[model samples]
Every structure is written in structure tokens, then in C-alpha cells.
Target: MDILMIVPASLLVFILGASIGSFINVVVYRLPAGLSVLWPPSRCPHCLNQLKAYDNVPVLGWLWLRGRCRYCKNKIAARYPVVEAVTGIIFVLVFLLFKVSILTIGYWAFCSWLLALSLIDLDTMTLPNQLTQSGLVLGLIFQIVIGFFPEGSSVGAIKHLMMGIVGAVLGLWLFDAIALLGSIALGKTAMGAGDAKLAAMMGAWLGWKYLLLAGFMACAVGALVGGVAIALSQRRFGQKIPFGPFLALGAAIALFGGEAILSVYQGLFFPVT
Candidate 1:
């Protein structure tokens, strides 16, 4: 990890990630409201005044402005810089783990999609199809592009592409099937088709085996959280718990830890002596 730091490159990557995060904030705010993300640009929600260039420099801008709109002087939400910082950290992690490869860029995109979608779902309880479908398409396209730059990696691009396709199909069908069964059992909308689509997007990056682990983690954690909320009287009976956040959490853990855990499982269950 220390060896891959590459201070100059990592700093640049962090800036790039923060910029992407700023764009994500735009998408999250506009997409749910049926507004074009590009048109209005960054502006104070209160004053409707467009932000100046210096006032929109990711984390630094928020600090410099003291979290107030320059023109209107309206207090800004702290969430903007928080999102930017978290995204920068996530990007740094991806770079450290994968180094400077096309794969690293793909993972960066994967993490960004998950982060943006998670924020939107947390806010609106809906996962837009546009983002998920775009992620799915890009994931497959990355597999194709990676073929030309194998770099002696173990997983060939073609095999990875097949795995991605199978993983996506399985994720869609299995999650939807679970949702159907849950609705039948609970007599309400337990989960929506958006979750199934999100699963497909995740599977495109995680592959089938890792997707299964991530799915299990999501369901298990979601149930626990719901139980805790009920116990604390924070949620009413039969109220919906947004699943996208838990899914993102699971995907993060799977991306970082799944390979090691799966290897241990294989060694224990199918020991080669």
C-alpha cells in the first residue's frame, strides 16, 4: 500500500475524483427532479444563483465560502464537500489497490456509480434506470477495452466479459425473484425493480461469485438495520427500508475483501493436500 502511494499521481487522482463527485452531486440533485443536470450548473438552492468558478472548487470552495452562497449569502449544506471528500478517498483507495491500470479506472467508475446511486436512493428512495443502465453498458465496454491491455493479468478480457454478462443476468433474475417472493409473502412492496437493476449493475463489476457474497451481505445487513430501527422506534411497522445503501456497503466490502475470503473458503472446503 505504501509503495503505491505515488504522491504526485495520487494527489492528481484525488482532484479528479473530487471533480467527479461534484458532477455526481449535480446528477443526484437534478435527475430525481426531472431536470437537466448540465443546464443549471452549480447554484445555491435557496437563492438560485449560479456559483462562480472559485466558489465551486470541490472541498476547498466550501471551505473558502464558509459554506455560504457568495451572492446570496445563504448557508450551504455541508453535504457537498462531504461527498467530494469521501469520493476522493474512495478514488485514492482504488488507485492504491490497482495502481495505474485501465482496471483501476474501471473500478473508479464502479465506485462512483455506487456512491452516486447510494446518495440518490438515500434521499429519494428511488434508483433511476438511466444511471444503472449506463453503468452496465460502461462496465461491459471496459471489459472489451481491457483486452488490448492484458498486462499478463490472470483473468482474460473475454472470460471476464462472459462472467460479467452471466453475473448481470443472474443478478437481475435472482434479485427480482427474491423481490417477487418477498412481496407475495409480506403482501406489500418489499423491494422494487430498481434494486434488481442495481444488482445487475453491481454484477457487471463484481462478477457472479462476488455478487452473491455482496447480495448476501446486503440482505443480512439490511435486515439487521431494519430490526434495530424498529426496536428503537425509528421506523413504523411495514415501512420501507432503502436497500441501495446496504447494497453499496456490501459491494465495497466485496470489492476490497471478497478475494481473500473466497480463497480461504475454497481452501477450507476443497483442500488440496
Candidate 2:
């Protein structure tokens, strides 16, 4: 692509991603509360004043307002801009990786929901079953549709979809069992139920091959990050740590880079250790 075309295309993708991220913010905030996401316009959570059109213009609006509500001047959560920026970056990467394919769209859609669920779980330590169930259906549809396309074969897409469903169930049940066992062993719950549900969502979307990969990656990342934080803070062992964000990260990676990762892993550890 020409330099001029590249800049324009990149800017467009970034804007679109940020716009979607704005909608995702609504879903994240309201879905758990059973609120109508579309009915009410965006408003100040502090003052409940309906936002003007300018206020809803993704990242630019937040930057213009200096991250404060125009009416109430309440400090808006910095997460708004952060989510938008992150989504924009991810979109640009997706465009590069898939180049106008349905794979791009499907993964983007998956990430949108995952973004909401990750944030909600971060805040409340709960994963809504509705989101996970919906994601499973969507992932199945995406797999079958993509399989039919010329580049890939649809011959076994259904089988993969079944594997995904089974992976989801197994992931959730295994986590639950571990939680139960740890509870019995330690006299307290060792993991949050929300973590199990979120893993199920990952399994549903990624299928067994990538779902297990994601689970391992998520656990590894969570341990490394959480360990560093605990060590720096001098926190006690077994302190509560949020696991949803790591799971989301893992799922995103699996969806986008699973094949490459598997190739690398096979190169390193092939011949069945």
C-alpha cells in the first residue's frame, strides 16, 4: 500500500475501532445492571446529565474535555480513553493481519464482547452467564461461516465447533472442581467462580486446541504479573488477584496468534516430552 493510503486507512480503522469501543463501554456498564443500552443516551454517571453529541465522539471528545464531564466536571473514569486507544491499536493490527476478511470482523466482534466482560469482571469480580452463552453461539457461527469460504475448508468446522463447546464445558467444570478441591484443602475458596465462567467463554470461542493454549497462557501471564505485583507490594501469598483480564488477553492472543504460537511451541517441545 502507498504511504498516503496507509495513513488514511489506518486513521479510518482507528476511528471505527474507537467508536465500537465507545459502544462497548455502554455494554460494560449497563449489561450487568439490566439497563437498556440503546434507550438512554450517554450521560454523566455522576450527574445523570445526557451527553451532547460532541461528548460522544470517542477519544477526541474525551481529550477535548480533558477527561471531565462537561456539565458536572466530575472526573470521568480514565478507562474511557484507555479502552478506545487500546481498541484502536487492536483494530489496526487486525486490519494488517486479516486484510478485509471476515476473520477480522469475527475476531473484532469477539474482542468487543470480551472487552466488556473483562472490564465488568474486573470491577465486580463476576462474569455474566449471558455474555458467555452469547459468545459461544457467535463463535460457532463464525467458525462455520469462515470454514465455508474458499481459503479454508468447512468440512470439519462443525466438529471444531463441537470441540469448542466441549472445551468450554470442560474448562468451566475443571476450574470449578479445582476451586472446590482447594476450598476443601485450604478451608477457603481458592478461586472465584467468575474465573471459571470466563474460561468457559474462552473455550467456546477458541475450541479445544486454542482454548487449552489460552488457558495456559492466561495462567502463566496472571502468575507472572500477579507475582510481581505482590512481591513489590509485600502482599501475602494467596492474596486475591483478578484473573478475568488475563483470560481476556489470552483469548485475544489465541484468536489472533494461536497458529504462530503453536508452531513455535511445537518447534521447541515437539516429540512429546
Candidate 3:
């Protein structure tokens, strides 16, 4: 694409992502409460006033309103605009990396879901099955469609599909095994089923190798965060902390840089045959 076209296309993608981020705020709020995401148009939580279209215009609206509800002057959380901005940034980054393609769309969808799930898990310590299960199904469907493309023969397509399936199964089993062992060691439940499902969803999208990389990254980051929390007296040792955010973060890293990182690791440790 020409530089002129790239600029406009990037802007469009960013706007699109920010708009979806707005919808994601709703999903994050409603899904946890078991409320219908469609019903009850966007409203101010404090004053229960329905927001006008101008009030809901993603990051721009927040800035224009000075992060306060127009009706009640209630302060809006900074997270709203932060989410919007981050989503826009990530969308632009993805476009830069993948350009325009079905894979880009798929990754965008995956990233959006991961962002929502991470925030929800951070807030409630629950990774809702609604998102994870649906995402798993969608990932499989995406792989199936991609498998049929001319990039590979029919046999290779079948193999690719099988890898995705096996990845999902292995991801679930890996997390479950960790959960079970942790429970035995701690004498209580350590990780929830939702996390396992989340791993499975990621595996379906990322395949087994990247899934393993994501798992390792999640563990390393989770441990660091946990240690910091403990050191700051924010959390007691053995207190439950949500792992989904770390998993989501890891999956994102894997999505963006896993191949390069794996190549470097292999070069260092395994070397070329």
C-alpha cells in the first residue's frame, strides 16, 4: 500500500478498535452481572442517565467531557479512555505487523476478547466461560477456514486442523494438571476451571508450541506480580490472585513475537541440525 493509503487505513483501524473497545466496556460490565449486553443502552452508572451519542464517542468523548458524566458531573474512571487508547494502539500495531488480511482480523478479534477477559478477571477473579468458550469455537472455525487455503495441500490442511485440536486439549490438560497439583500441595483449590478453558481457547488460536510459550510467560509474570503484591502487603501469601490477566498478556506476546523469540531460543540451545 502507498504511504497515503497507509495513513488513512491506520487511522480507520484505530478508530474501529477504539469503537469496539467502547462496546467492550459494556461487555465487561454486563457479562459479569449476568445482564443482557444488548438491553439497557449505555448509561451513567452513578446517575442512571442514558448517554447521548456524543458522550459515547470513544476516547474523544471522554476527553471532551473531561471524564465526567454530563448529567451528574460524576467522575468517570480513567480506565474507560485508557482501554480505548490501548485498543486503538494495539490495532495500529497489529496492522503494521500483519498489514490487511484475514489473519489480522482474527488477531484483532482475539486481542479484543483477551482484553475484556483480562479486565473482568482482574475485577472479579472470574474468567467467564461465555467469552472463553465462544472464543475457542471461533478460533477453531478460523483455523478450519484458513486450513483450506492454497497455502497448503489438503493433507497439510488436515494436519493443521489436527494440531489446533491437539493444542486445545493439551492446553486444558496442562492447566488442569497444574491446578490439581497445586490443590494437593495447598490443600485447597488453586486455579479455577475458567482459566483452563481460557488456556484452551488460546491454544486453539495459537497452537501447541506457542501455547506452551504463553504458559511459561504467564507463570513468570504471574510470579513476579504475586511477589510484588506480597512485598507491598497488598496480598498475603497463598491468597488467591487471578491468573487470567497474565495468561492473556502471555498469549499476546506469543501472538506478536513468539516465532522470533522461539527461533532465538532454538539457535542458542538446540542449534541447527
List TM-scores for all candidates, in order: 0.93, 0.90, 0.96
lDDT of 1 by residue, 14-75 (tens): 99999999999999999999999999778888889888899899999999999888888888
- lDDT values for all models: 0.89, 0.83, 0.92
Tens digit per residue, CA lDDT, model 3, 101-157? 878888899999999999999899999989999999888877876777657567766
lDDT of candidate model 1 versus the reference: 0.89
1 or 3, which is superior by lDDT? 3
Positional deviation of 212 in candidate 1, in angstroms?
Answer: 0.5
Give the C-alpha miss distance for residue 122 in model 1, angstroms: 0.8
* RMSD (Å) per prediction: 2.3, 2.5, 1.4
Candidate with better TM-score, 1 vs 3: 3
Better of 1 and 2 by TM-score: 1
The candidate maximizing TM-score is 3
Which regions of candidate 1 are displaced past 4 Å?
Answer: 1-5, 151-156
- Weakest 10 consecutive residues, lDDT, candidate 2? 150-159
* Per-residue C-alpha lDDT of model 2 across residues 1-273, encoded as one tens digit per residue: 777787889889999999999988888898888998897899999999999898889888898899899988989888998898888888888887887788889888888878888889887777788887788778778767766675566576766667767878877887788779988987887888877887777777777788888888888998899888888986667777667888898888887899999999998889465
